[model samples]
Target: MREDVGEVTTSLHRPTTDSSRSKPVRYESFEWPQQQQQPPSNGVPRSAWNRQHRRLSRWHRPYTAVLVFLDLISTLAASEIADVFLEKSKSGFQHKSWLFLQGSALFTFFAYVVLPLGWLLLLWTNGTYDRRYLGLGSEEFKRIVRTSVTVVAAVSLLAFATKTDLSRGTVATVSLCALLFILLCRVTARQVLHLARRRTGHGAHRMVLVGTLPEALEVYTAVTRSPAAGLIPVAIHITDGYAAARGIETPVPVYAGRDVLSLVREVGADTIAVCGSASAEPGELRRLAWQLEGTGVDLVVAPQLTDIAGPRVHIRPIEGLPLLHVEEPTLSGPGWLVKNLLDRVVAGLGLALISPILAVIALGIRLSDPGPVFFRQTRVGHDGRTFRVWKFRTMYVDAEERKATLEELNESDGMLFKMKHDPRIFAFGQKLRATSLDELPQLINVLKGEMSLVGPRPLPADDGDYLGDVRRRLLVRPGITGLWQVSGRSDLSWDEAVRLDLYYVDNWSLTYDLSILWRTIWVVLKRKGAY
Candidate 1:
């Protein structure tokens, strides 16, 4: 059995004797292997792993900062050449060394000095430079790109509105160059780090995996693929009796036993990565915690949650229990204000920009069907209040009657309803839904204050009534587009849908809302998970 008592056992010596005088006397010396024992030391175990991690984190940022600074300086130099070329073409190839010098200096100041500084501030705000992000996924890259673009965009707008006489061509040139160089540099750095990690077989923290074969395999794949995360699975402890076949062909050795602590120490891992059910009793997990209290090792529990972002999960300690608090998603309070304001402003601009297209869709719908182009249905909204949710009619008027016949084919779980390939969709409705054209009229709902630009998808009364204890989805104003729609829409399981809504509810922030909006554009463009 695995042990965490800081004790090791060797074969014990036994005296040979016969109860009766029938057996001949045998003299033998058997020496077992020596067992190493720790000397009496401090009660608290030292964390060599933590020290290494912290030290690496300290050096990571300055390295990236230097790369960013040098890249921007290179971009400024490129912009100078581009500006000189444009000037010569405009002024009969005149040799204006003074003009070139002045333009180059200005570009250097704005792109290299100002823009990088602004990016640094934004990165600080977004936690982009956090040590935890160092060995993570493309998330860090995405954040860097986002922060850089935002800074450049802000500067551009400021230059345009304030008449700063900043050369627009030079700004664009430098911004594009800097963005490309930064992305390339980051990608190269990741590749180098990945190679180094694999070659040395160091940097990765050893892990004792506790789960069934299938779950353990999944965890193993995740850790192996993400080398930068530094999670290395050294041993897997299967709880099932010796009958189940191992699911993964991992280089790491596998052992079956009930002693979790022994397995942890045997594998030389302080971190116990729990993935699935184990042979140990449920209370054993807590008891193991007690055993490792001052061992300076972390117990990392990997829940079955997948594809869920961290911002959505909330931990609330309740009555000495660590209760997970999932908030219902809504667009209200300042979010409501922001969405309402954006709705009016963007809608007005869109109407002015795309009046012809809106006119075309209206005329096409009118021509296709001899009914109202706008379909409004009663949907449960914030605080369980009902509102008329508007959409371009993407179904025949008898779609409700048809739904009753398809109830047996409903694919979704709990109160939600969905079908992969529904028979009730109108001729153009399939195209409309796939491209998210049906959601356009909801901009009117946004304007009417019945909906916001982003929130949980407003559910109809039939589904809402069947919500049982899961109807916390109505806490905030209904949204035109929401976490559900962008995430997987009709394809998501009921639990996942509710979990996402709860995540949005608990972590409501303007930044999150904007992120959702930005993601919505991609979701719509991709048309993934849409029926």
Candidate 2:
């Protein structure tokens, strides 16, 4: 069997229509057969194609197998532990005769065999083993939790329907322990996978980006920014016709989108990411999906929506058409009220717990510099209200007066001023800033309800007023630390900082605040991007 295809490389030169400007423009073009004109297949045997497809896409199988083994161990250990606990407490449930087993034998049979098998079945049925959710995002954990809930509900319903005297304590203990153990195993597995991807690019998808030049480049940038997400671009398929005419330069080999299936096969790409309006033609996307049906290539559509978190977006299928519904941001309401209440409570407790350290730092600051122990500055707060933000003095008393001399040395690219090594910061102050202990005094602001435990960082009043959409950051109280601070603090560009702040304002929740606070601890310990 042979595949019929044609490839041609040609150089064309066209002279200008005007005699006064008769300079010829030269360009290179490569042409291939149209989509319908190309061969239906690569002429490989079906068996050989199956073998090749498995070889190309089974890279994650070993990782998935490891998770399965871990889950098995977790469930078995949980059952045995529950059995031991029940036995020691003299509260074991009596098992009546069932087939050839009775009493202790029957209990052991169910505990050792039936329980683990049922747990694994539930996990499989809940899609816990899906490769897409394995090593990224919170979906894997969420699925595990959902599986655990299902197990509890199923067991309870079975006991009720059968009128079996099932021990409530046994079920709760086994379910809770199994959930914890499996979650721990998954966290460890995810960290290992992330490390492998970062170090060796292992277990990553070989992605082919399909879109116009600009849209493809945008998707490429976003995916490549976080290499841990594991969508590696191997080729580009330009959907628009003007790419060749304008001679657009791309990071990877560029092909006309007329034959994306052929392009994927040629590049050995396992994922095709369609970006922006690449499939604007009617039924074009569905046709592409049809072409990729059994070839083991995953088709992913990258919508133009950027920075929208998953919780706010929902897919509602109406008449077999999926419509994306975006819930409005939780700027106010009961959830916001809960967030504000928790902020004050956590702040108050933090201030009380860290009072001794605060005093020691204040004394050290007074001894090292002749300035006030606390540095107070007016900052724009919620609703554009001006609040006096407090921080342990980390600069000289005359730091404000010396600002003029260092204005020429500004290293930051925004309204803010930042220098990696500023003469204004004293020795003790550098230590304070390095560990972010300087920001601890802001807990007082948080306690006073002028700041939040997690939100956008408040800007100094003198540091240019917020303009345009940037003012949205003021909808919530400024934070002691936020996405901007944990992301890179002084290292992020002005626009990037604003983008993160706006993202926080649009996605604020108690869970988000807690995640930020957790990341802040790690960022502070690493002392990354700090002066």
lDDT for 341 in candidate 2 is 90
Stretches > 4 Å off in candidate 2: 1-52, 91-103, 242-249, 318-320
Q: What tens digits encode model 2's per-residue C-alpha lDDT throughout 126-214?
A: 88889878787777788899999998998888878987766677788989999999999988898898888889887788888877768
What would the TM-score be for candidate 1 when compared with the true structure? Answer: 0.57
Cα lDDT tens digits, model 1, 201-289, are 44456677877767777788767754666677877766553235335465567655335544454446647777745423445555555
Residue 82 CA displacement from its true place in model 2, Å: 2.2
Badly placed stretches (over 4 Å) of model 1 are 1-131, 134-336, 464-469
Which RMSD does model 1 reach against the true structure?
12.1
The lDDT of each candidate is 0.63, 0.77
